[model samples]
Every structure is written in C-alpha cells, then in structure tokens.
Target chain A: MRVTVNGDPRDVPADCTVATVVAEAGVAPDERGVAVAVDGDVVPRSRWAATPLNPEARVEVLRATAGG
Target chain B: MLDPRPDDLVIAGVPLTSRLLLGSGGFTRLDRFERALEASGSELVTVALRRVEQAPGGLYDAIERGGARVLPNTAGCYTAREAVQTARLAREAFGTDWLKLEVIGDRRTLLPDAVELLRAAEELVADGFVVLPYTTDDAVLARRLEDVGCAAVMPLGSPIGSGLGLRNPHAIALLRDAVSVPVILDAGIGTASDAALAMELGCDAVLCATAISRAREPERMATAVRLAVEAGRLARGAGRIPRLDHAQASTSDAGIPDLTPAP
Candidate 1:
C-alpha cells in the first residue's frame, strides 16, 4: 500500500500499522515527545500498533519545537 | 519588590504569579534559553509544533527543567481547519489542552485572520481546549473571542518580531477594559519599556520572544523584562496621576529664599 509520511509518499507492506510506519521512518520505538495523526485525527501511542493505515493515508508525525 | 497579588493572574483556573509569559524561541542555544527562561521568572512558556524531524532536540526537556508550564502554539497555520488540526496535534504532543491559537491571514504582516481565528476558537472551545487566541488589538474582536469561551485574549501590540512596540495603546486598553478574560499583550514588544507600557495600559500580562531572545544579552534582557513587568504592574495598581498640559512645581514657593532679582 502507498501512504504519505510527512508529505513524502512511500510504499509499505500490506496491513501496515502506524507503529510499523513510524519504525520504518527511522523513529525509534522509544522516541519521546512524538505525536502521530492519521487523516487529521490523533492516534494515541497505545493504539499505534493496532491502528491500520489506509492507502494514501496522510500521516503526520509531529513534535514540539521552539516557537512563540 | 512588592509581591504580585496572590491569584491575580488566573487563566483557565491556573494561578500564575508572574505576569510575563516567555516564548521559547529565537535563542541560539539551549543553555542560553534556559538562563533566559530562569531569569524571566515566567510561569507560562510558549512552544511551537512542527514535523518530528524539525523538532528542537532537548528544547522541551530544557523547558521542563526550567519549571514552567508549556503553552504550545499553532503559529504557522493559515486557516481554521489547519489551526484546529494543529491544536489537536499540539494537545496530543504536549498532553495539555492549553493552546496559543494563531491563524495567520497574510504572509507579509503575519496578522491574525480574525474570521478564521474566531472559527478556530469556537471549535477549540467546543472541543474542551483552553483557547488563548492571538488576536488583533480590536476591542470588538476581543469581545467576540471572549464570547466563544476563550480562556484569555492575546492582542498583538504590533506585528510579530517587528519590535515596533505598542502601536495602538488605546486599542489595547480598550480591549483590556472590554473583555472579562485576561488580556495579554502578545508580540511586538521591543524592550523593557514596551513591556512596561503594555502592563501600565492595563494588560494582565505580556508575552514576548524576539524582544528578549534576539537581544545581544538575552539573559539580561529577560531579567530586565521581568523587573519591568513587575514595576509596571505595581505602578498600575498604584494609580498614576492624571496628565496635564501645564507643569506643577514639586517645591513649595514659600520655603524657597527670595534670591531672584526684583521685578
């Protein structure tokens, strides 16, 4: 299946979950301060492994940065 | 120094002693940001959300170590939908509903789109977020934001990072008087005097970043802003004398010797 991760399109294996996609994106499993949202809805960390991604789903992985 | 009135600044039921809200941006290094944050004595600090790869390493940790509560902002969003989505993402990332809502209307001025801002504020408020909107210094708009159940209304003194100071003191004062929620003077503060002026004009607090972070000595500027805020608050409470066209002599004419030449 094809999915867009952080505005970049990529092909992932079938039945890929958010956790797998995150891991494939080089984000360590223990990485702190990261939040993931699928199709504009937040996916809690506990549900990442169970939440399946649809084809062409927009996954936004965000973290806090310095700002005003 | 006089202690700030206990429970004076209550935003969304969170009591804060410091009227200066610092922004954790523009600092060249984490150590300096830490020093500036410590010196500012701000209990509430603002942070922004971005892509994971763009996240500043150790910035959140430093903010935590400084012992201030974080108020994540949707700074770069340009629409109601984008702002709402960003707020949710920020809430998820920070584990807090406190948001500094910003929906930019234009690229050049970086002004808030009042229409989109109100739309986003209404949605966020309905979603149980403590919305503190960054709005223009317009009294009616401030009231409209308060009507949508915003925790506070943050009016810009001028454009962001302009360092032009309070461009419309009357408008800020009007908003301060018109809204029941806290009126925080956000952005366009150039120096300590600007912060002081904002406070003196009846603002509950002043939020700033570039003024301090971009200064040659950020830590020192932070201290100055803190003191200036305190002084301004005290002065406001003290009730300044009314302005007059003519000067009034401080010395008593009767006590002075008659050394002047006879008329």
Candidate 2:
C-alpha cells in the first residue's frame, strides 16, 4: 500500500494505520502540538492509532509555527 | 423590562468568555506566550501558519492546554487567492472554520489592503468559512464587509505591531455604530489603558500581540489588559452618568427648622 505524508508520497505496509504513518516519519508519541489531517479532515490525536490508512490517502501533519 | 446579561461573545458559534483576544506570536518563547495567554484570560487566540518547516514536536499543545479556541490567521498572505487557500488549509489542520483574515497591502506599515480583504472575505464566507477580516478603521469599508457576511470586522487601532495605542477613537467608534457585526479593535494597543479605551468606545473586542508580548513584564501586562477590558465592559454596561454644570441646593420645607433654633 502507498500513502503520502506531508505531501511526500511513500509506500508503506498494508497494515499501517495513521499512527503508524506518523511513527514512520520518526516523530515520537510524547511529542506535543502535532495535528494530522487525512484527506482534508483532521484525525484527532486520540483516534490516530485506530484510524486505518488508505492506499490513496493524503496526510498532512502540522505543528504550531511562529507568526506575527 | 430589563435585558439579560449579554450572551457570551460567540464568533461562528465558538463561545469566547474573554473579550481580550491575544495573538500567539512574538513572545520571548512559546512558554512565555502560553503564560501571557493564561494571564490575559483570553478565550480566543490567534495562531499563524506558513509554508515552512514543521517543528519536531507539535506546536499547538500549549495553546490547547490554555483551553482557548484556536483561531488560525492568514497574517502572511498578500493576495486573495493565497489568503483563501490558506484559510482552507487552516480548516484542514485545525478542523475549525474560524479564521483571522489578514490581507497586508504594504510591508512598511503592514496595513491591510481593503480591496483584497473584501474579496477574500466574500469568498471565504461563501465557502462556509467563518471569516474575520483584519481591516482598517474605515466605517464605510466596515459596512461593506458586514454586507459580505463577515462574522466580525477587525479594524486596526493603528498599523500592525506598532503598539502606538488608539490613534483614532472616533473612527473606531464610527466603525462600531456602522456595523451590526462585532467590531474588534485590532492592533496598535500599547497598554492596559489602551485596551480599556477601545472597549469603552463600544468595540466588541480587542486583538493585540506586541503590547503584551514585548512588555518588560509580559504576564503582568497581560493581566492588566484583562482587567482593563473587563472594567471597560462593566463601565459600558453601567452607562456613564451625564455631568451637570451647576449645583442645586437641597430643600425640604418641613425639615431643617431646628437648625435656625426655631427663629
């Protein structure tokens, strides 16, 4: 199966869930302020592990950034 | 016969208990911003997004811990298309329709471009986004924005990040009367007194960043602004008693005879 993380397309195992996709990206679970969106809808942190990934899924993870 | 206490200031169905709106930028650090936000008692705070690197850890944990409604802003965009697209991206990231629309026209002053502001506001409102345009202190422009379905119109007290304080109270007051929607006095606030003055002039809320974030004691200033906003709101609610020029003597024909020793 294939999934896109943060606009970079990559191939991952078929059993991967959204949490697995992020874990593959190397972000630790204890890290804070990270939000994930799949297909333009936010996948709340609590549900990330349970939500399965799709082959054509487009996921974007954003952290709080600085601005004026 | 009497009105109930004013309802919670709701923007796009988000309940904001605090009238003082704080920005999530320009702090000494994220922890500083978080502490200042807590001190201010602000229920709605602004965060910005750019096409830049994402931090290793998430950036929104502290803000979420502050227990405020997260309102992402398009502060860096200069065009309608970019602002609109950013708004959509924010909705996707935060899963909230609330947005702080900022369309800057010039870099020197960071003033809002009224033309692009209206364009972006109209587009966002049509697409089911709760658009809050950071605008100028123009009454005519404010009316036009309300007509376009803006949830709130934020007119600057002065240029962004200037902190020069309320430059034109009359114009802000005019904007207040001219629009039926919430009129937020955005930017140019330097101190707690400034925030109080804006609310006294009938602004529904005040949005400021540098005033508190750059202060010598950021958290202290934040608490001051919070009290100032509340004092102003209470004063407005109490209504000002008109002044009288001449003093009138009190009279009671049946009383005060004893003061003359029955003479």
Candidate 3:
C-alpha cells in the first residue's frame, strides 16, 4: 500500500502500524526530535506503537531539531 | 494522575508541549544552546533583535538549529514609538509579527512604564502584530493591555535577571483571573522549583534565561525545569486537597456497636 510519509508519498506494506512505518523509514527506535502526525492529529508517543496505518494515510513528521 | 498534556498550554493558538519557554541568550556557544533547548523541551524560544551593522552572525542559524518558534523581543526601547519602530524592524528582520514588547520607563530599574506599555500595545495591535508585553504584575495594567488586543501579557516575577522567582503571586493570580490572554511569568526564575511554583499559581508558562544558561549543567537543569513545570501544571489541574485545622485518622469500629450482628 502507498502512504504519504512526511509529505512524500512512499509505498509500504499494507496494514502496518505507525511504529512499523517509522522503523521502515530508517528512523531509529530511540530517535528524538521527530513528531508524527496523521491526518493533522499528532500521535502521542505512547500510542505510536499501536496506531495502525491505513493504505492512504497521510503522515507528517515534524523534526524540531533545526528551526527556532 | 496524568500530567497536563500539550493541549493545556497554548499561546495565540500555538500548542506548546512544554510549559517552559527558553530565552536564547547567555550561552557560551551555539552548540550548548542547542543542547539546552533540546533538553528543555521548549516549543517557544525568545531571541533579542540587534542592529545589522556588519553582517548577520550565526545566532539565527543557532536558533534555527534549536528548532523552536522564535519570538523576537524589543528589549531596550523606552517609548511607545520606539517600541513600535523596533517591532517593525524585528518583523522585517525576523519575518514574524509575534513580538515581546519591552518599553522601559527608567534607566535605573528598567521596569516597564505602564502608560507607555499600553500605548505601544494599542499601536502594535492596530498594526497587525501579536504583542506580548513584559510588564509589572499589575492587574489594572494587565487588563488594559488585554483590552488593547494583546495576544499575551508577560508579567515579570521580579526584576529581570534577579532570579527571585514569583515575588507577588497574589498579584499574578489577580492578573490571571482578570485577563483573557495568556499570563506568562517571565524573568526572575532561579531554579526548577521556581518554574514549578509559577505553574502551580496557574500561569500559562514561564520564560527564563539565566536559570538555564547560567547553571552548572544547563542541559540537566533544563530537563529538571521541564519536569517541574509539568508536575506543577498537573498539581494545578488535580486540585490539591485542603488541610484541616486538627489531625484525624480513620479507626476501626468497636465490638460494642454490634447490636444486630450474627443474626
């Protein structure tokens, strides 16, 4: 299935959770400074692991490590 | 109880995950400032404007590296006109309408002049700026500023750089109840506990510099402050139980009261 990741469309395996998408996108599990939002709603850190990603989900990840 | 979430504290509709706001000054190096910002979990950071004499230094880049929304402060202006002009300059330089308006009346104490502050806030609000004035903890002045369309009113806990914490919480509470805008406790925070106390008094946020930058370990202290603000905000939401005049304890019932027992 195709999902938009951080504003760029990318193909991922169907029925993947947010944690699986994040891991597949080459982001380390312990990475800091990345905030994930799905359909304009921020996914809290606690719920990220269990949030299932739909096939056409739009995900935006903001990293505050670079702007003030 | 769960901590107060990001939706609890907001400034002008901007959601802030951390109740602690950082000031981008007093750091020896940009890297240190970056570390401190990350550790502080501050979503809003303040930067002072300077005249572009020779060239724009790396401070802007450093601030960008820290990744927080920048709030440019008008630190040294004395009059309403001067502050308005400085706000324009800051807008042109920083490309943001959000301003931390500081209109000083006296050179000795450097306190904000209530009259000039309201005057500046009125003009700035008219000019389509989000004015956040740093002023004394006066309920009247706070109400006036709010009436003038200020986005927020930042009352100093004490004198700037004093690190004395909230000197007049009663006045702060009055302002909190009077104004509709966010009441941010700015300046005079000495330690993590100080920031926590400010939050416990129902402040929207606390802005500080020396307490974080001047500490022995800025990063660690930044984390401490972040946790402190969260703890205090939770406490405020949880509603502390009142104390009683005398001590009391739960007791077991005696056998003499078993009139109809074992029937």
Pick by lDDT: which candidate is best? Answer: 1
Model 3 lDDT tens row, A1-68? 88987667888877688887667655567644344667746576568888988888987543322111
Decide which is better by DockQ, 2 or 3. 2
Evaluated on chain B only, what are the TM-scores of all the candidate structures, in order?
A: 0.95, 0.88, 0.88
Give each prediction's DockQ, rounded to 2 decimals. Answer: 0.72, 0.25, 0.01
Q: How many clashes (backbone N, Cα, C below 3 Å) per candidate?
A: 0, 4, 1
Ten-residue stretch with the least lDDT total in model 3 chain A: A59-68
- DockQ of candidate model 1: 0.72
Residue B64 lDDT (model 1): 84
- lDDT for residue B118 in candidate 2, whole number 0-100: 96
lDDT of 1: 0.91
Interface RMSD list for the candidates: 1.6, 4.1, 13.1
Candidate 2: stretches off by over 4 Å: A1-62, B1-7, B51-58, B241-263
Tens-place lDDT digits, model 2, residues B1-263: 22334656766655677888988667747777888989999878888764224442334667778888778889878999878877877776677788999999999999998999999999999999998899999999999999999999999998888888899999998989999888888989989899998999998888878888889989999999999999988887788867689865567556555555654
DockQ of prediction 2: 0.25
Please report the candidate that would top TM-score against the real structure.
Answer: 1
Per-residue lDDT value at B48 in model 1: 89
TM-score of each: 0.94, 0.77, 0.72
Best-to-worst TM-score order: 1, 2, 3
Strongest candidate by DockQ: 1
Task: Kindly report the fnat of each predicted structure, to 2 decimals.
Answer: 0.77, 0.41, 0.00
In model 1, residue pairs whose N, Cα or C atoms come closer than 3 Å (at least 3 residues apart or on different chains), thus clashing, are: none
